[model samples]
Target: MSQTPGDPRHALPIRLNVDDSDSPADVVDALFLGRFANGEQPYSHSTSIERVKPGATLLPPAAEVVRAARDSDRSATLAQGEGWTLLVSRWSRGADVTVTAVSDELAEKVLREAVDGAQDEPEPQPENVTMGFWYVSPRRGPHRTTRQIAAGTWAEVRPNYTAPVAEAMDRLMKTTPDDIAGRLLLLHGPPGTGKTSALRTLARSWRDWCQVDCVLDPERLFNDVGYLMDIAIGEDEGTAKGRWRLLLLEDCDELIRGEARHTAGQALSRLLNLTDGLLGQGRNVLVGVTTNEDLERLHPAVVRPGRCLARIEVGRLTHRESVEWLGTEEGVSREGATLAELFALRRGSGPASVPAQHDGADAGLYL
Candidate 1:
């Protein structure tokens, strides 16, 4: 028997002795492994797609190469051709397909044919960008969910920032993949100072070359070794491969504050490791963090030289800019206003009032 390079099946036992105590599922799995032990057909190809088109079926196309077919819920199909096997499984959000064949070329061809027209092409929405959300579920452990979010281009939202911040953002918005100098992006500011808004636009500007994902629960992510490893090691599916990924962690004040070493223990160290240490090696990943703490209050390790791609302090607009933005000085203050205040004033409320935060339930996830 021959074995393909890097294939884990090479470690399996040459023969299996199943006892009566073995469960049916275990016996079936053993039998399945037995068929591949000979290594006659060692080539394999696999891909996963998100947002599978509605009403699309994989069974029909899978039948093109195989004689026998088995399907369930019209969403999963399995078929076998001479010296080859194909499997397609789909759920509400996405689908995964895999093919194993005697030759690498055959495996690739079968996979391509099975999913030729099954994926849903993302429609053009200039105001929207697709982002991934990562969180640890009680039942499923670590999981990622993709969503299309509404976000404006930097030009449309330029007036929301002060001059200096706007200038810095101008350069950031125009950044290409080649301009990436470091692994971490730090955004620190007041709660209502448009930090999240800036991140959303950043996602839009870098959409062509980067994939953005938000870790919903940052505290749990770093504290759980298993969860952290799952996220750090997982590969982006389909066309997202080879693209840089920005993992956005919001409101992480406790994790990066000056006292983080005493408070967060290994959490802070793990975060730094993921940014520029051994864990980040060979992984095209960037960490973007939004914190309410002032820059001086952040841990020194997080702000040291050469570790950050950008360290932006998102602040309130100047008084003049606020007056100009509102077109009237009626509710504007001499100290200027945050983006949330501006929105509140526009809605007929006073500048002191906070606008309702967008939870993104109806318009998709934001921030």
Candidate 2:
């Protein structure tokens, strides 16, 4: 089957198996983990088949297991699970290459008609779901805009009650869209204090109201924050105020090197300037930088009042917080550490050790 050409959504590897009877040519389409490059879809068209169940979109890359059973009859195979708009190359016989859109069943219905017409009696199995899988057909263009991991995807931390972070996010959202233009919003704190977690939730919840979302991965900062700003410039502003492209800059402390005002330091300063200066005035950019740094030591320019318009510290959970976590059925209890430490420990897989007391302070993770 000739796949319609399009840019790859994820450069990450995806393995699809085609048995001997099945022509490698029909071996098109790929299933990726979650939204590749964070849902920045590159191609368009056609749903895919599944690995385990007869039908379901493969949401995680880890589930990219299993293979196709090649029957001898030469009938078109069912569309595999959902497509992640990946790029794949192989040889095959069938050729249906047009990026068309259809409902879950209607889509499979059309494919069923196209491939099985006059070939075999169609089985009406209700188990299969037919839905558009963004990219079975491809497109010609630059690769999908790569993801800048400024913010991570939001996970449901709690149900029913909006998490505490929502209070802070409420403030962020209530801001007049105009107020968000070129402003820096910092969420900083000790590790496991939920700074990053909170930001993830904020961005995801606000996605509908915002134009575009871009995360600034720490890995990308091979250099200056200036490079980060350049990303904001290039991203499309699908809606006004240049779609809300929130740059999630983590690891703020790592940026400060050399004496303050040195070349690198100035570069760092420029990063802050880019957000707060004329460049930021109407760009419609809201930078949410999370760091474990002491704000006072940060360059006055970067740490100034309006530079990072709002500075909120996600501190240690209180004693009551500890009880809440420990008393919970699913969460780890505060047996080995404080509520904060226990939370981190549970999230980790490696074995943990409790160090001996210091200054007669037996209180460490044990506390």
Candidate 3:
């Protein structure tokens, strides 16, 4: 329960810049941010991260970058940028904000404004309150570089999906506020659209909802650390929750890479049983896994009626959504193109875009 600031035992650091170009987002030691806001204190006893809104924006470092713009009384929507990536929002105060995929241009702008001031358009408000404000995303690992993906990499994909993105987030992040409110909630989304970034906020929301011990993310493990068959066995007798908590797995498809192998087989079995609610104390054990893959790929048993219990699809974004959000982030001189447009036109029908194709993607877990 006691972990020093440098104690890797409590908060292990993943490699920074896990993949080329991508940083912080992939390396963070997935944590349930809900409790962070309640003043539960961070796992790192020595180093205390400033508490800001989940996804607040920082004004560009322009000349006279006042906290509040003179003309606009509304505590100027916050905006922060690194390179081309830029995250814009205002936190609800006393929340920890960690924005990712910021652009260097925005970075320079922030710096310039920090020293000087520039007249530009105001910043954007949240798509909704649940979306989070004042991001606090840092480097994913010790070696990972800082990023602002929510600002840069993620583009809107509303047109791609039949449901509203904000609604999806609400349904995903919002639960009954049960005892296990901090349990895992899986989410799936296409690449370059913002799955990891969304989870960042989800983690924050989870922490905000309940007094959680730790929020564990399996996505980064699957990607960088690979599937540690050990975790498949279920959590140890001791955990932060003291009883049970959430464990999120993003892009679970990656776990199926070696289904034929003995280790993977055991791993798959462990996942199936856990998802089926066969293991762990049901009191507060909630498991969520998101995949671009279809349900067929997932073991029927795992995703079946009672196993997964709840399954939701994160569809592609509409043309308009892409244009509006990305347009704002990209600072498009002309606004007509959409995120769906860019995804459709620029990229091919690759596996990343066609997540539904991976249907039964989590099927193996049930099998």
Residue 106's lDDT in candidate 2: 37
lDDT of 1 at 276: 93
- Alpha carbon deviation, residue 96, candidate 2 (Å): 20
Q: Spell out the clash pairs found in candidate 1.
A: none
- For each candidate, what is the lDDT? 0.78, 0.43, 0.37
lDDT of 1 by residue, 184-210 (tens): 999998767888888999999999999
How far does residue 74 in candidate 2 sit from its true spot (Å)?
28
Per-candidate TM-scores read 0.72, 0.46, 0.38
Q: What lDDT would candidate 1 get against the real structure?
A: 0.78
Better of 1 and 3 by TM-score: 1
The numbered model that scores best in lDDT is 1
For model 1, give the 10-residue run with minimal summed lDDT.
358-367
